[model samples]
Target: MAEEKNSIHEELIDETVATETVEGEAVEASEIEGEETISLEEQLKIAEAQTKELEAKLEEAENRYYRIQADYENSRRRARLDLEASEKYRAQSLISNLLPAMDNFERALQMEVDGEQAASILQGMEMVYRGLLEALKNEGAEQIEAVGKEFDPNFHQAVMQVDVEGFDSNHVVEEFQKGYILKDRVIRPAMVKVNQ
Candidate 1:
């Protein structure tokens, strides 16, 4: 009977040790699972940060693209306006070159002729002057009326001021050189004497 009791006591000790080992293994497994959950949360946080960074870069790139597009539009508009202005004044230089020749013609026409040959030459010159005037008129150019008109600085340049009979104050008394208008723009202002 004593030997049987000893054997029963040893068996109970062994069973208790086995239960402790199993419980320890379960605790270790739970710890491993908790670590895995924490690592997953950390991974999610890192991914969120990277996504936000990429979004910021994308917004910056979009803003840069918009700015470049606006600049290109403005440059194109400016170039178009410049081209239009150039077209509007295409004949300016040619008209400017003809003014000195017109002045010479006027001076020659004023000379007195004393003989038949001289008078015939003068008649031919007058015809040429008329033809020149007609040609200028056809090109949208016209002489500014300065003599006996109001002295406007836009069309007349006052070179001399005088008190003249039969003329109002601030009126053009005599034109030294004729002014001309090419289209709507003034090519030259008339050099004139103004009445005081």
Candidate 2:
């Protein structure tokens, strides 16, 4: 009876120890699972931050591209305006050369007027001629100097050389036809008679 009682006590102690070991192992496994959850949360937060940073960089790149495109459009518009202005004034030099001929027409009309109606017609034609000249002059048209000035090959052409008593040599004696300049460049050289 005494040996049986001792054996029963030893078996109860072994069972208690086994139960304690199993509880300890379960607690350790729970702790490892908690650590793994925390690590996964940290990785998620890092990924979210990287996504935001990439979005910001993409927005900045898009803004720069739009600004460059706007600048190019503005440059193209300005070039077109400049080209239009050039086309409008393309024939300014040629029309300016015709001013002297118009003046001669006006003088002839004035000297040959016979009646009130005739004089009125001549005045109307002169007005038209003046309007045409004014329009050309406003667009970079200018007349070249010829008569009574020193002969310059840059602005004048000697159609005939004349021996004049009073004028110095190489002086412009007469302008047969007027010349014209445009924007400081001689478009048509003055046809003149130069002194010998």
| Candidate 1 lDDT score at position 58 | 90
TM match of model 2 to true structure = 0.47
Error of 1 at 141 (Å): 2.1
Predicted structure with the largest lDDT when compared to the true one:
1
Error of 2 at 100 (Å): 10
TM agreement with the true structure for every prediction: 0.65, 0.47
- Residue 26, candidate 1: alpha-carbon lDDT: 38
Clash pairs, candidate 1, are none
Residue ranges of candidate 2 with Cα displaced over 4 Å:
1-89, 92-111
Off by over 4 Å in 1: 1-66
Worst 10 residues of 1 by lDDT: 28-37
Question: How far out, in Å, is residue 131 in model 2?
Answer: 1.7
Kindly state the number of residue pairs that clash in model 1. 0
Q: In order, what lDDT does every prediction score?
A: 0.81, 0.72
